[model samples]
Target: MEITSVLIYIIVLFLSTIFSYPFLKKLKWNSKSIPYKLPPGSMGWPYIGETLQLYSQDPNIFFATKQRRYGEIFKSHILGCPCVMLASPEATKFVLATHSELFKPTYPKSKEKMIGPSAIFFHQGNYHSLLRKLVQNCLSPGSLQKLVPDIEAIAISALQSWAGGDVINTFHEMKKFSFDVGILSVFGRLDKKHRENLKENYCIVDKGYNSFPTNIPGTTYHRALLARKRLSQIVNDIIYEREEKKILEKDLLGHFLNFKDEKGQVLSKDQISDNIIGVLFAAQDTTASVLTWTLKYLHDDQKLLEAVKAEQKAIYEENEGGKRPLTWAQTRNMPFTHRVILESLRMASIISFTFREAVVDVEYNGYLIPKGWKVLPLFRNIHHNPELFTDPQDFDPSRFEVAPKPNTFMPFGNGVHACPGNELAKMELLILIHHLVTKFRWEVVGSQSGIQYGPFPIPQNGLPARFWNESNNT
Candidate 1:
């Protein structure tokens, strides 16, 4: 009996060794790879960790709860990796500017795959700088001045379409408007069918950027991949056509075709296609989110709405009976309109936080952000902090009359990685609001609700509203 028991124990031990070796090996590798002091906080559950709460919960609540217990900088596992969340302005500046080289841009695997390797966010150092310069040339002040007329035309047409409607989804309309702006301003003019097709593919791709990474047939990620393939094919066809026709146009695509890098090497067909996708990703939905929030905020405040209307009315009155589309000077000169956009962005906090991963294990304020761990510069936390903005939850555009304290109002981000499209986005919003308030007015259909914070800010129920042309006064 004793001999039989000994054999059973040996068999059990041998089976456990075979089953556990791989996991143990990985565990050992992780420990050795990040053998440095970690910041203070919990890692939560074993595998999934704090990702669900950090991403799925109300951002203010999540950060507040964590901050209460763990203080300003805390360590946790989120978005499938270990992360150190930096909630203070100093920390934000450190990662975004001061020691930015130690932390490179990183996104969820799903986002990286969807945006592609050629996207600016995927590059670092010199390559990123060069790509940014190329993109900046396309969206430069000179280019924007030329593009304003087209933008105003699109905004006017979209508002006209919204006329005579009882209830419309403000978010959906803004999305369509922004998408059309991308099609025209980035790719130049296209036939309606081609434009619609591109919009459809982009919408599909946008839906899955923050989705699970699984590629099963029925998954959002799978659909996103398919949509991306279709989008690539469309872009490639345009590139070929432009090349064959020797089209020397002035839009973004034209700039790409003519762009010669420091080595005198222009972007290849695939590179151009990927970067265009990046432009659309950066420009469209994020602008839509801010626009929707602007509508919601304006509709809720009649006094503020009238003030905004007056500003636009003056601009229109200057245009000799509003006959000409808005000029770049007109758009740039709307101080109140600009302030309102800034306030809406601050209130909505469209981009909750941005992620950067440590390329080398580094120490900040005595806390260690280990190599490969993500560092979250908490934008929303800073935007909503009462210390930063008085009555932070109040919808007040006037607060932006004075410039926000440095590092405290970074809706478009700050430092080296600041969004190249920031000026263009602001111009788009200013133009859209100018048209909306001057030509049309909208009222909320039902009770206005709070915003939902995912990767973007979504107004509850898409902010359904009844629209009226100012002439009709209905």
Candidate 2:
């Protein structure tokens, strides 16, 4: 553990890996090809690379500093891999859409291990296509329509509970609300106590998502692995219970159970558990962040709040005095509210970036994207670019009245790897907004503060806010 010994060990490891590179390449499963003409950028210090800067510094500043020096598209080793970061819509499109086949999906080792190999995010070719199709079918418009009443019920209950609490943490509350909705929508309405236990285990799993992949005892990743095992057990138990009782429920789990791919192969129990976890993992944080920031933005601007409230109020009246569950028709009619959601997503950039690995050496704007190197579509930079949006720093929902140029606003991401659950996430937000704006009055309790970005930007104060049922507003 001495410094000199540590340095010697690192040096030996580094050299041994380099010496064994050819042998590693010939492993049949090793997908890496010889990297050639890698884009201009620094690989940083040894194995650590530029990862420290990415995690330690503010993401905006880190990206901006690099962009200023290296131009829109530049190379930098980050997060344990050498990555070519793209900032422009054109480059984003090329990597995410145009030549998407040339760039396969890649994610952190921790994410890959935790989310499982069958999860859609890390998949490609026929397998990824099958998973995507299955997910789309489960979350289709008609399916969502059937599920909306339950979603509304959950939202109403959550908001009602929030109404009675004092000085609530808005982000935490929203996460719990969304997480609960995810559980119900995916697994059908199960026992409340079991659902709560599942939520607790999921929390541990979520925390380990961005942690180092090391499985050493007492590490976050170690805890996450354990939690993942427990969650798998819980899911398997539910599946077995449903089968034993001869219950066939119409929910995501049921859809997955009955789903057969082109190969006519049904998902195994482990595949089912892994994909379910992947669904929860994808929807939970981003949805919660969007909900929290939307409310926070609305709270900061009274005029905007009134405008949003008016929009919701119109929908409320249209639904026969707000007594009905939000149908798909009603959700589609809330154009202004949709614009607000889009604007909030533009500003918040809940998912800052996503990774893709070059399947082959690719050329872009005369630069070489060497095969096997990771490519990052910098969603945050693209969303915030002045060229893409005038006065990009300001929050203006009206801008969405007319869409920006194609691929200019990818909050959920772009191309085949784009989030499949975005509509569901949007529906969850829309429902929460409809209820919140129509039935509640809320305000921040203290002076507004900046957001602290850790994996995602969260209000530094946890967005402490006071709330009252709208009836008590006067």
Candidate 3:
């Protein structure tokens, strides 16, 4: 009787173990798979989510404070969306370069409507590739070489206009200069009347770009929409004229007009018009802002300004004291001036951050970034990192004498969506600075210390300043 009872107990124990083995295995696997937690930091209040806090203070301070407290990657809600801010170079590259397919560029719908939805920056895949190729082709090195003389002419004209001893808003004047250069690239010497029309309507659109997005009559945004329609009409008129004349030149518009896909599908008028306006929009503000900052920096640091002038003056003398147009080779060879531009880009960090939306739940550094959340690579945070840059706050062009780490210096951003117009922008800056420093001197007027953001940070009151022709003084 004892042996039979022992046998029954052993069989029961064996059957129980067999039944529980699969359950135990599954539990272990589940624990490993679900271990990730959301990153650190405050999401602010429930609905508005720190939008007020962000706008209420200097944006750089807000970001820098957060970085100090919460480390490189942190969670916050802004503009009514949950976001994970990536301040480290590795994280930035992961989102923007390595795993870019997992994230898509995101912008406010109002901005898309303002800039037109078909713009290259708003897209990915084949459509974006097509537009980017066309843009790159027109702005290529060879093409830019051809544009040097024209850009020089525009730069000379701009400096002359600003040299009348008026306390002009430097940022505003720079905007006009950049707009003309933008026009030259897009249309290649557009007629004065069409240029004026585009400028008038574009200014209205610019005013409403950051305004509240409401279609109610008389609102800034509403007026902007009307202006946008008129701009489209103007672009269409130009297209018609080009077609009628059979004008085929190597400009942005020419590239657009000449494009035909393997399917023989050419870009539509809306595509062309939207892109033209988009290029103008892209070309104008950021370049103007950077140029404004360059002036402010140079004005504040006279020693550095003199150094830049010395470099440019040598080149100027070579060109017979500005009698000859600047050559592409001369522009390319301005090493010190190039470093100054690099330092300025780093110091200003004009494109502070860019927005990307996660298309899937992503795991990074053992943190869970849930799908449908916004991910912003804080370019400003990276640019201002003390570890990455020694004395990051101090304006030092010499730091750029050695190249920045792979992804650490992204003033123009990085990865596939990097600015195609960056070279042209650099060329514009080089030409403008060469002329301004060699042929002109300027004095900053008013309080020279505060910053204001007209959507882009500019010195307070647009760095009110007077410029004088040094040649005239001589």
Candidate 4:
């Protein structure tokens, strides 16, 4: 067993190094246009580029090394492609907003691999517009208000399960709650049995997102393949069940069933399922990660905690004796709570690098970017830039207490493809964190006590927290 484990480790490491070694040639590319611009960064030798630094988990090292060498906005390679690093607000806005049409993400595998090709996250052109329209319509403030009771119920029940003041993995807890909330909002309860089946089916696609490229037995990819099938089956069955009964509920799945395209061809059941799974992937995982870091920051900073608590207490008491649970109004009223979540998002975003495909040569800041060059905008670099954000390393919610600090903050991303579920995710984080701070307190353990990342980046430590009732705080 020991030998086998060592061999797997050696093989994975060997392949990783080989994967990165080819890009050294690209290092010779000239990028003198924005030599003295943007936040500092680098693209290392060959194909490895900045990704090797990304794999290092400590992102600051990438900037620390790059800032010391390349300054910023220089040519570099990442994910095995030669790309330019753009960080300033003007450059970023140009890519995400001004010339967004020219730089849409058309990568086949990016949509198919990270998120399924058909999922809303990867959809482009008219299809992207359609999916965004559906999501936006469904997630409108009026609809979200109705989801309050549903969200509150799930949150309360989850919190109740943390009975023993136990050392809880806040990250996993958040993921589970988020998954439940997202599923319910998207599909409705329908029935207890149907909901259970849908949840089971959901995991198949979820697992696929993280699987290796290979889809063979004994591989995580294989499990993901099976999971995707199961997830699809569950959604299909729900659609079939609803169709058979001539019943339509207001849930996301039902909404899709009733949707019509420009040509008026009804969306098929699989299409609906695929979009839900896609949105779920975007909403659940990212929100869970943000919440995990929010807890970490709240636990580490006592003043922030007290401030959040004070705000929450006032909000909770204002709606005193109301039996339907804290309404959406109550949740949004917690100013400090929202600020902390926003700050955490700025500090640690699950999506740090955004990929864009260039359709034509674009000129900016005196540099002509050739057509077809992959655009890689460093999301983290701008957000944590000390020049834009004071004492960037520190977790201070007050920085965002007013408005976002311009180019330095784009957590859900920016412009056209920015997460449509941004409002929903923010609401969930604020609501959940509000409940956690009032009900319990927590602390980190071990070297990994703080935040960490994996692949798309998640809290490496799972954000361990010691939970307790408000009585303990007293």
Point to the candidate with the largest TM-score: 3
Candidate 4 wrong stretches, greater than 4 Å: 1-53, 106-114, 321-324, 445-450, 472-474
Best by lDDT: 3
> What is the per-residue lDDT of model 3 for residues 1-474, given as tens digits with 9 covering 90 to 100?
134533543344344434434533332223255678889999776455666577666889999899999999999877667789999999999999999989999998889999899999899888998899899999999999999999999999999998998889999999999999999999999998999999999999999997767799999899999999999999999999999999998999999999999999999999999999999999999999999999999999989999999999999999998898889999999999899899889888889999998888789998988777889999999999999999999999899888889999998888989999999999999999999999899999989898777678888888899999996763
Candidate 1, 1-474: lDDT as tens digits: 134543543344345434434543343224455545667888776555665565444667887788778877998865446679988899999999988899898865668778777888777788788888877888899988988888888998899888886789888898899888877778877767777878888888988886656699988889999999899888888878888988888888888788887689878877878888988888888899999999888888889899999999998889865887788888889998888899999988888789898887687887777676778998988898899999998988789888889999999887789898899899989988888888886788877986654358788777888888888854
List runs of model 2 lying over 4 Å from the truth: 1-37
| lDDT (tens digit, per residue) of candidate 4 on 135-199 | 88888898888888778778778887864667778777887889988887788766788677766
Q: Which regions of candidate 1 deviate over 4 angstroms?
A: 1-37
In the order shown, the candidates' Cα RMSDs to the true structure are: 8.5, 5.0, 15.1, 4.3
User: What TM-score against the true fold does each predicted structure earn?
Assistant: 0.90, 0.89, 0.92, 0.87
Better of 1 and 2 by TM-score: 1
Model 4 collision count? 9
lDDT for every model? 0.81, 0.82, 0.89, 0.70
Against the correct fold, how does model 3 do in TM-score?
Answer: 0.92
Worst 10 residues of 1 by lDDT: 20-29
Better of 2 and 3 by lDDT: 3
